[model samples]
Target: MEQWKDKVVVVTGGSAGFGKAIVDAFAAAGATVVSISRSPDEHGGNGERGNVFSVQADVTDDESVAAAVSQIIQQHERIDVWINNVGQSIRVAFEAATMEQYRQLMEINFYTAVRCSLAVLPHLEKSSGSIVQIGTLAARTGWKNIAPYVTSKHALSGFAHQLRIESPDNVHSLFVCPGPIRRDDAATRYKAQSNGLGDAASTPGAGVKISGLDPEWLARRIVTSIEKRQPELVVPAKARLLFSILQLSPRLGDWLLRKFAS
Candidate 1:
């Protein structure tokens, strides 16, 4: 944490949820945190330390993302960590989901990270910085409904794996996979409308009984992981065991998932 003092960090979709938590945590740790989102800050300005900055940018638009990164670089001169945290999900079934919906999901969940990483790579290389990609348990396995969302997450996870191999030794790429974070209103609504499929609220752990994690706690863990330059992180600890079990015995895993789904 002490090492992060004066470091520059960028978080996309930092206006709310996990992104907001990450932004607040980094800013409190004395880092210059730049938050990019489609919405402007209602508070208008940085935190008390003047370390937090907000930039309104639609990450799906390449020019907007590029310009936002340019502004951050001009202000801070370098970026020590870039967190690609902007993502959205739809709870509709595969057959019910439109192709347009799938394309939109890809743009938000997969391509946003790709574009941001490309924009930040040069700065990361110069600073020996890291890129933390927010992944989900769905990336490891498919779940009921939300096929597009799950697929996009899988794509991002694959990208992160390849990125780790291609990126310079100094530039680290880390993937954080967490299961069923506590649902907000939008998520709750989506789950309610889902076609008898389980979601974060009704099935908080997917196939397990564990509750969702608090955003702040997850954010702190992410920051610590970044400091250590870990390759991958999975929340709740128990999920790691489940992930391994699924790999060794997918049939059993599927059975458990079905049981939970029921």
Candidate 2:
């Protein structure tokens, strides 16, 4: 679909993984991609085969996020899609996880998205732009050891749902919740299995061991959903079934998660 062609798109956490993939896909499809990340990527300015713009911003920092949004507006005049994709997690037992660690995760995963959404809401409303939130199956299924991550994702989904409820006539808010993908970090961590904790995402492919939808594939789905103006969608196809089953029986879903989430 050429709906994204020539459009202005902003992706947070654009330096790597799914966010980076989304930026690449949109740029390749002819959209002007503005990438927001904590640090400037080595490959940021090149745009390589497509149009890519990099904006260094820490989603946890309000001023930084605001400046990045301002820069995008100054350059693009309007934003056609504002995607909130920044997320961070620390795997730790509930008792072991310090309050500071919990706060850190919340700041990055929940508050960051909130700040970005608020910053771009006016722009998105003006352009009738689409707001896509990159969510996780963790939001649906809570894990025992990762309470902080679980809670943050839960909050993220809650925020998205609230936004959907209050969405303007022109603007659309979509949440793309995908299950765990084969990430190299997760795999390596799984291999190491110290204390039975799986995976360390110290590099690319760190999260590739688990079955996952290709980032590019997910991005295409996002684009298609935007064209059709879908409210929210689960990626990898299987997520739809899981999403339905979980929604139908939340307690059962939680039981299954607790059973298998080792």
Candidate 3:
């Protein structure tokens, strides 16, 4: 990957999970990392590196997203990378899931990304920056009990596809579909190191152990793709083949998932 020295990177949902990993990766690559999330204090990047900033914002709210984006632009004057990582997952069955839960999931997983993209598109277009939306394997596959979560991701994936085609100049739009990652472990380590709060598995779909990839390694791949301006990427080599095969024959994929992945 090209050196990110002096670059400005903004990561939403940055207080935890893949968002936190992406922020730290960019910071380590020498970018000025802007951590945007509702709980900025939770993952406030320590000043030891003198390159990380935390901004409080609710991505699902357009005003909040716009305000946060404005603040970043005012402080840094340009954004080199904008990562949409805010999302939520619940494992309730389609009929069992409450209407409110479905709406909330859609807001968090899909609308938030749309709102953030609108907030930053002008700035990103100006600088020919990159936009990365964190996705999941569930986006392409069906989950027995997490219908809402899967549906929301499917919508987000479609939105990312549209954005890539519409974006002008070198303004690259990419989506990352990764499998389950061990968030609690990272959270414990981060807290112990006093760098920031670690990510915990809080969703209804939490403990389902699918094949997991290391966050650090996935972060490296994401950085490399962003630098190269690739349109989409899947973490871990296995995911690419699985995603392709699943895409071609979803019914068989769903059957296998129900038979074994459950």
TM-score result, candidate 2: 0.85
Give per-residue CA lDDT, model 1, range 1-262, as digits (tens). Answer: 5799879999998877888899999987778898887855533543223778887788888898889888888878889999999998667767888899889999989999999999889999999999989989888877876788889999999999988999989999999998767757533456565647544433444334556688888888898898889999987677777678789999998877666553
The TM-score-based order of candidates, best leading, equals 1, 2, 3
The clash count of every prediction, one per candidate, is 0, 19, 1
- The residue-by-residue lDDT of candidate 3 on 151-175, one tens digit each, is 8999999999999888786689989
Candidate 1 residue-wise lDDT at 114: 97
Q: After superposition, how far is residue 51 of candidate 3 from its true place, in Å?
A: 0.3
Considering lDDT, which of the candidate structures 2 and 3 is the better prediction for this target? 3
Superpose all Cα atoms of candidate 3 onto the true structure and report the RMSD in Å to 1 decimal: 6.1
Q: RMSD of model 2, in Å? A: 3.6
Q: Each candidate's TM vs. the true structure?
A: 0.90, 0.85, 0.85
Best by lDDT: 1
lDDT of each: 0.82, 0.75, 0.76
Among all windows of ten consecutive residues in candidate 1, which has the lowest summed lDDT?
199-208
